[model samples]
Target: MREKAQESVKAVLPVMVIVLILSFLIAPLSPDIMVEFMTGAVLVIIGMAFFSLGAEVSMTPMGERVGGNLVKTKKLWFIIGTGFVLGMMITISEPDLQVLARQVPSVPNMVLILSVALGVGLFLAIALIRILVGFALAPLLILFYLLIFLLAMLAPADFLAVAFDSGGVTTGPMTVPFIMALGVGISAIRNDRHAEDDSFGLVALCSIGPILAVLILSLVYQTEGSFSPEIGRNIATSVEVGQLFFEATPDYMKEIAVSLLPITVFFGLFQMFSLKLEKKTLSKILIGLVYTYIGLVLFLTGANVGFIPAGNALGTVLAALPYSWILIPLGMLIGYFIVKAEPAVYVLMKQVEELTDGAISGKAMQISLSIGVAVSVGLSMIRVLTGISVLWFLIPGYVIALGLTFLVPKIFTAIAFDSGGVASGPMTATFLLPLAQGACIAMGGDVVRDAFGVVAMVAMTPLITIQILGVLYVRRETQSADRSTGVEYQVDISELFAEYEDDEIIEF
Candidate 1:
């Protein structure tokens, strides 16, 4: 547990150092805000460690067990029905979704939230069916994205970026652990060689559901409002920073309790009806749940109270500088490290390492993800500076990613798409989004049109970069096979066949 906590600190420390350096060199902040940011960073590091450990012990096991049990019954309707219910239940409670819903001005919070949840539920069912039936991921991706774009055409201009961003934010820290584990559990039942490949793409499919659903909803309900920038409150004294965290604690506790209830109840009922696990295992899960609850509360509180204001302030200050163009490279640099701080990235990377038996190391996955996110943040900064449409980048970016899908291994395609959502977890929503919004505001750009797609961009880039890694992996394997064949050719044919002389000998 202590080691996990240290790992979280290491992941987050680089970003913290970058922020401090910026504060000192260029984007100096108010003493109060700096104090708050420092305090929040501490809480986030601690919270992330606890959350990661809890997800390993509790969420992963529960999801896997439930998924495994559901498939054992072999009832198609039951599987789809359970998938839908579970998807909706888990999504409705997602902290990142809640944060996103609050920010979108056009749609009513409940309307958007329910729309996103329903989308996830439906797509999750589709993903389950695809796995069971052995459908190809590439074609389904092309088809659904085409549908999303068609709906995007009908959606209000103001809602277009928000619609796509919904997909990225919905599959956040809480959702990824459960959904990824569920895929593992379901695919475990399969005896096919592609079962490992099938364990991925569930998150990828679930991500698309919210985008399509929200875009359709946008067309049906056209409401016009603007995102109101959060006004910074005056802090008279440094002590007030501690007071701020204290006051925010109960609110997050209540929110997390509400968010966790449906999933908890659902899991309990499932266990009673089907799981029937041993007492010791159940006790461990319960304890882990406690850890998850506490960790999430602290994590969200730090992010919302500490990071958001600091990010906004920093962006505003930097963009107002004489050499405002620095924002682009600065954004890219921040992007490289910010993804490391995301809790879900750790989960996905560890899962990939384990699934591939270390053939794909977690370190390699992190480097690929960081590069992808760096490009994304650079593009996002360009959007902020110039007020360009997100479509310009997204269209070609996804086109290239989908094209690579055919060229890479099936498992890489699945894992690449999954990494999109994992990369845009809570840290992106809480810190990067606000930074973009702040810069957009400074540049007099439309916050919705310009700043909102940062999450979507963050989500899109990994699809291409990871698949690039896939292309290299395939080449390496081919070369290894060739070298083995060459070594075989060097052996004496007479000697090779000598051992089999007593039996029926075969010649090439």
Candidate 2:
């Protein structure tokens, strides 16, 4: 518990420091807002710690068991149906997606939420099918993405960014651990060469479903509505600050409970019918569930109430300056550190290290994600300032990302795509999205078109950067093998990569 708390502090502290520096020196926030931000930061740290421990203890094991048991049945229809049901339940519980649904005024909250949930459910079924059949991930990704773009061409301009943002937000802290573990659990049953590679890409594919669903919905239900920004309230007293959080606490507690209920219920059912695990293990998971509930409540309250308002105020203040171009670099600086703050990132990094036997270091993945997010935020700020269409960047960005899948190790492609979604977790939704929205408002730009896709950009860049890391990893390994063997190696690139993959997995 103490170690988890320490890890949470490290993950969250950098963003706090950056915000403080900006608040104090660059764009001063009101005293009450500062107190709120500080108080929220404390809750965020504590919440993340508890959430991390709980996810590891509860969600990961539950998902793996369910996935493993489902595969053992060897019934394709059963797997598909269960996968879809589980996907919808988990996605509907995702707090970040809920936040987004509230902000998009044109669509009814239930309609949008259900649509995104359905998208996730369907793709999750497809992901499981791919793993079961050992189908390649890249071609499927290309085909779906092409379809997404075709739909995008018909999607209303106002809906374009929100549609893409849907993809990123759906794979938040609540969803990533379970979905990734499901992939691991399913792939564990496979003794094939590509099982590890296939263990990823579930999150990647699940991320896409939300985008396509939202885009298609936009086409069918086009309506005129402006982006709704969170209104920052004025608080003069310390008592009000306390009252502010006190008032918000129950709402989040309820939200988190509702968010966690489906997964908890499903796990309970699985335990009854399938797992039949020993009492001690069940007790541990039950306790973990309690911790997860507490952590998420605190985390959501702190982020939505404390961090978001501050982010908006800062973005508005900074962008209104004479030389607002500073926002590009400033946003980049913040983005670099902010990705570290995402709760799901730790889970992804830890799993990657464990699965790869440290061949791809967590530190390397962290650095690559930071760089990718930094670049993405910079581009997003430029869009906020200049009002460039999101498609101009997204189309080319994905093309590059998808194109690299053929060049790099298959595992890297999977991990990279997963990183895209994981990288754009709660912090991006609550802080960065508000920041972009605030900036867009101040710049007299269309908030939906200009500010909304910050999450998408954050989600896109890691696909390329991490794969570039994979390419470099491949080149270095090739050189090392040549040096060790004292002979130049000439062979098909895929063949060489396969040799490395087998050797790396064996070294574990």
Candidate 3:
């Protein structure tokens, strides 16, 4: 319990400080606004504690256990079918996906949501199959990404930007911890010693499935719209922060409850028939679910109320300045700090460092993620400043990443992909996106074309940064090999005789 509190403080306290600093920088906050922001910050801290506790209690363990049990099936198709259905269902429940769906113009919300979910479902199934079959991660990535890029070339021009962004936002906080835990669980089922190494990348590859699926959807819709950036989101003054929380509270709580319902029902049915979970265990998990629900509500409310408006206001004020080029460096600074505050990232980086026995340290991973997200933020702000095609950056970026897939270590290939999804946390959507949107508005650009892909850019750079780490590791290995080759192998017979004489060798 103390641990969870410390974690929450470490995560939420920094953001609260950032908020206070921003409030001061803006027009001197009225007294009411000051109190409201403070209250919202408190709520956010409370929410992070609940959400983190709930995830540990319910989400991660449940997914891991279920994943282990589900993949025990001898029948391959059954596992695939389960993966497909679960992926689709989870995406349908993802708040971030719903948020992205609403922003997609002309497409019916349900239709687009369903399509994106289906894309996730189909790819998730394939990802599971890859794990089970024990395919090399590198080659598989090359093949699938090659197809994705090829499809992008032929895909509708208007839909290109949207296609890539789907890959980013679909794997937000709600989906990452559970899905990554599930991968760990499922991979543990493998008898191979390398199974632990293989467990790291399921979310990574699963993220791709959406990109490919969306590009296909794009083929059906013509999206050749003019490109411009704009941002318009409700900004809360200190007085209005509490009001924002109240307004956002009910919807997120209801949505989160509904999201968990199907999975719980499925677990209940499975337990009744097959697993029969012990009373104590069942009770604990149920309690954890409650924690998750409470946590998500608070987290969402705080993010919408305190985080989003503050970020947008700051971005708008900065972008409107004559020295708007400051947006890039400012974005990099914000990106560096923003990642540390994302709750799920702590879970992931800790797990990786532990699982690898320091082969990959959390500090190193943190540094890589910081650099990646920083570059992404800079790129995103540039898009806000000038309405460049998202493809102009995305295609080249993905190509370089995919190219690195072949050159880097297998584990890194997986980690890189997962990092993309992991990087697009709640902060990205609730705060950073709004910031870009606000900047776009300040610049009078089209919001959908320009601001929409910030999440995509956030998701892209990690794929490269982590892979570069992998490349470095491989180079060190090569250097070590070459150095070892220079050493001569010789028998020190006289020294052996002297050592043997002193030891009085027993075996002889």
Candidate 4:
């Protein structure tokens, strides 16, 4: 746990330093706001550490146990039903989703929230069934994205960005650990060689569900109110900064409680009926849940109260500069570091490392994700300045990403897509999105069209960059094989599939 906290601090510190430097040099902030930002940074680091540890100890295990048990039942309907319910329950409780719902204009919070929840639930079931039946992930990905775009054409123009952003935000800190583990759990039941590869695309598919759901909902229920970005409250005194956080703390505590309740109740029922976990394990999970709750409260409070205001202020300042094009490079730099700070990215990297038996290193995954997010943020800033339709980016980005699916190892495709969702975690929602919103407002651009797609952009780039890494990975393996003197060894694309083909089935 101490080590994990240290890791979280290391991950977050670079971004904090970068922001401080920016504030000092380019965007001078008020002292009170600066202090609040610094305090929030501290809280975020600590909260992330605790949350990461807690998720590992509790959420991951619980999800895996439930998923594995359901698969073991050998009743298809029961497995699908459980998966759908679990996905909905966990998604509804995602704090990030709630944050997003609040920001979107004219849509009732519950209406948008439930639509996204249902999307996740339905796709999660499909993901489970896909793993069970050994369905090809790439084909389904292509098909669904086509469906998403078709729905987008029919939906309101302003809602396009929000629909795609919904997809990214739905798979956040709370949702990632459990949903990813559920894939692992369900895949554990299969004795087939491709089970490992199948464990990956659950997140990828679940993400798609929300985009499609929200786009369809947009067509049916048009938003009438125009988006109006909230202005951050000014802190009149230095002491007010502390008071600001202190007062907001209770509100977040309540929010976190509400967010965590559904999952806890569902887990409790699962424990009572299906898992019947040993007392020691249950005790550890309980403690971990407490840690998770506290960590989330602090994290959300810090991000929403501190980071959002600072980000908005920074964006406004930067956009007001004579040379505003610098926002692109600056946004890129922040994007690179910010993704490293995402708590869920750590979870995804760790899981990938374990699943692949060190074939794909966590460090490599981190670098790929950083590069991807960096490009995304840069493009997003361009969009904010120009007010271009998101379709301009989405169309080509998905094409390149999907094209690479055939060229790279199958696992890379899955990991790449999964990384898309993970990269756009809480930090992007709380900080980067606000930054874009501020910039959009300053530049006199449409907030809904220009600012709303930051999350989508963040989500899209990983699909391409990770697969590019996959190409290099294949190259390295091929060269290594060719260098052997005694025997002529050939590297086949099928060899990449060999890792998952091992018949060793994991047992709960």
User: Which candidate has the highest lDDT of all?
Assistant: 2
Q: Once model 1 is optimally superposed onto the true structure by TM-score, how far is the C-alpha of residue 77 displaced, in angstroms?
A: 0.5
lDDT tens digits by residue: candidate 1, 340-406: 9998888899899999999988998899999999999999999999988888888889999999998
Q: Point out the worst 10-residue segment of candidate 3 by lDDT.
A: 225-234
lDDT of 1 at 364: 84
lDDT of 3 by residue, 12-98 (tens): 666567656755774233344345445656776677787778888787888788778878767788889988998998888888777
Q: Show model 3 residue runs off by greater than 4 Å.
A: 18-39, 155-158, 223-243, 474-508
Better of 1 and 4 by TM-score: 1
Predictions: Cα RMSD each: 3.9, 7.1, 4.5, 8.2
Distance from true location, Cα of 192 in model 3, Å: 1.3
lDDT to native, each model: 0.88, 0.90, 0.77, 0.87
Q: Which numbered prediction scores highest in TM-score against the true structure? A: 1
What's model 3's TM-score? 0.88
Candidate 1 lDDT at 160 equals: 78
Cand. 4 Cα-lDDT: 0.87
TM-score of each: 0.95, 0.94, 0.88, 0.93
Clashes of each: 0, 0, 11, 1
Select the stronger candidate by lDDT from 2 and 4. 2
Error of 2 at 259 (Å): 1.3
Error of 4 at 388 (Å): 1.3
- lDDT by residue (80-187, candidate 4, tens digit) is 898898889878877777766865667788988898899999999999999999998999999998888888778887788988998898897877888898889889
Clashes of 2: 0
Residue 248 alpha-carbon offset, candidate 1, angstroms: 0.9
Off by over 4 Å in 4: 485-508
When sorted by TM-score, best at the front, the candidate numbers are 1, 2, 4, 3
| Model 2 residue pairs with clashes | none
